[model samples]
Target: MNSLIRKMSMVITESLMSQRTICTNIRFPTFLQVSSPLLAEPMKKKKKMDPQIIKAREERKRKRIEKSIKKLEKNTKQLKPIEEIDWPISLQKQKLLRERTETISQPQQGQDILKAWRSYKYQQSLQETKMIDRISSSQLQALEQLRAISEDLYIKAIQMDDLLLPFTAAGPSSTPPIIGYDVLDGEYIDETPKWK
Candidate 1:
C-alpha cells in the first residue's frame, strides 16, 4: 500500500510541475515574428564581363578626357577681345585726318596769356573762399543769437532731424493741380540713341 501511495504522489507531483511550467509560459506572450521583404527575395547573380572589353571602355574614357583637356588648353592661349578696351576700326581708319601739324608762332605770347588766366582763376578762388567764410561767420552769429534767446531752442536746432531721412521732393510744375481730374496713364518711350 505504501509503495502504491508513493507512486501515485510522484505522478501527481510530475503532473503539477508540468502544469506550473505551462501556466508560467502562458503568463508571458511570445516574441513577435518580424520579417523583411528584402530578406525574403533570392540574391541576384553578378554578370561576368570580358577583361579586354573592360580595358577598351577604360581607354575610351581616358581618351575622351584627354581630348577635352586638349581643347581647353587650346582655348587658354587665345584671350577674348573686349570692344571697349580695343580702338574701333572706324576711328583707326580716320587717324590721318585727325592729326594736327600746326606749331605755336609766339611762345612768349602764350606764356603771357597763361599768366593772365592763372591770375583770373586765383582771384575767383579768393572771392569763393571769402564768400564761404562770410556765410559761415553769419551762420555762427545766428546760432549765438539763438543760444542767447533760448538754450532749449538752440539745442533742439542743433539736433539732427530724423524725419527728413530718405528725402524725396517733387519740383513745382508750370500748371496748377486740377481738382477731380482723371489723369491718363501714358506708356514710357525711351528716346535715347543706342551706341555700338
Candidate 2:
C-alpha cells in the first residue's frame, strides 16, 4: 500500500508540473531572419560605419588646434634677449667689479674692495657666481662670506631706508612697481613718498 501511494504521488506531481504556467519578467528578443528557403524570410545585413563622418570629425579637430595656436600668438608679446637686460644699481656695481677683476686684484690695490663688490653684486642678482677654477678652501669660504656680507648689507640698507618688499629691492625687477601699490586691506599707497 505504501509503494502504491508513492507511485501515485510521483505521477500526480509530474502531471501538475506539465500543467503549470511559466511567467517572465522581461520580453524576449526579436530574432531577425538569418537565411531561408525552407524556414522563413530574407537575411539581415550588418550596419556599416560611414567614412564621411570619420573625415568630418578629423577636420574639426585640426581646425580647433589651429584656432588655439592663432589665439596664443595674438595674445603674446615678442620675447627679448638676455643681453638687453638693464641690471639694478647693486648688480651694475658687481658687473663692473667682475669685468675689472684683473685691475681690481692688482698687488697693493684694495683686494677687499673687489670682494665687497662681488658680495654686493651677488645680493643684487640673488644667485651664485658660477666661477669654478678650484680655489683653496679659504678662498671658497671667502667667496661664501662675501655673498653673506652682501645679503646682510642689503637687509641693512632696507632697514636704513624704512623699505618694503625685500625681493623687489634686490633682484632685477621683471615688473617694476608703479608709483602707487595696493596694500593688504585694498588701499593704494604712493611708495614714492618716503615715510618720515
Clashing pairs in 1: none
What's the residue-level lDDT of 42 in candidate 1? Answer: 68
**Winning model by TM-score:** 1
The TM-score of candidate 2 is: 0.20
Which window of ten consecutive residues has the lowest lDDT sum in model 2? 28-37
Give the poorly placed runs of model 1, Cα more than 4 Å off: 1-105, 162-196
lDDT of 2 by residue, 48-114 (tens): 8698998999999999999999988987885644765856779877885667534544554567777
- TM-scores for all predictions: 0.30, 0.20
Off by over 4 Å in 2: 8-46, 77-196
Candidate topping lDDT:
1
